[model samples]
Target: MRRPYFDLIATGAKTIEVRVGYAKICKVAVGDSLRFTSSDGSLFTRITAVKEYKSFDEMLDAEDNTGIGEAGMTRDQLLAACRDIYPPEKEALGVFALHLAPLPE
Candidate 1:
C-alpha cells in the first residue's frame, strides 16, 4: 500500500482492495486475513467477498471506484493508475477484487 491509499484504508474510506492475479494473489479467498502495511503503520482487514475479472478494464467496470480507489476518482483515471502500476503483460494474467472489512484489533 502507498500514501493516500494507506491513509484511506485506515480511515475506512476505501473498502475494496484490487490486485493483479499473480500466483500469490490467486490464492486469496473470502474469509482470509490481510495485513496492509506502510512505513507509517499497518491495518488488518478481512476478506468479505472475492471477484475475479479477466482484465483491469473489466474489474474497474464491475467494481465501485470509490471502494476500490481514491474517492472521486473517475473510472478512466483509476484504470490509468492501475496500468501505471501494472503493465499489459501483468494485466494479461488477470485481476481480482477483494472486498474488505476492517478487522477488530
Candidate 2:
C-alpha cells in the first residue's frame, strides 16, 4: 500500500521522555500556503500561521500519527483533495480548518 498524503513522525522531545505526534492546526509551517480541493473539484487556498502546542510532547504525538499521500498527493495537496471530498466535516471547525485526509504515498 502507498503512504498517505502526510506522514506524522514522532521523535523524542528534550523535556519529555517519550516521543509521539499529535494532530494540531499548527503542524503546518508558518508563511506556507495550503491549497485544498473539494469533492466537487473546488479549490481553496490559505496561508498557514504559527500554532503553538502545550508541550513538545503533544506536537510530537500529532506528527507521529499524521499521514497522507498517494496518487501524486503531498500532505498539503492531499488535504486539499480531502477538503473537496469532505467539505461538511470541516464546516463546523471554521472556514479555515479542514478535515483533510492523508494522501497515500
Question: Relative to the true structure, how large is the alpha-carbon lDDT of every model?
Answer: 0.88, 0.32
Candidate 2 residue-wise lDDT, 11-101, digit = tens = 1111111111234443554444443333333323333334333433233334422322233444455445544544543433322222232
Q: For candidate 1, give the lDDT.
A: 0.88
Clashes of each: 0, 39
Question: Which runs of model 1 end up more than 4 angstroms from their true locations?
Answer: none
The positional error of residue 88 in candidate 2, measured at the CA in angstroms, is: 20
Q: TM-scores of the models, in the given order?
A: 0.95, 0.24
**For candidate 2, what is the TM-score?**
0.24
Per-prediction CA RMSD (Å): 0.9, 15.7
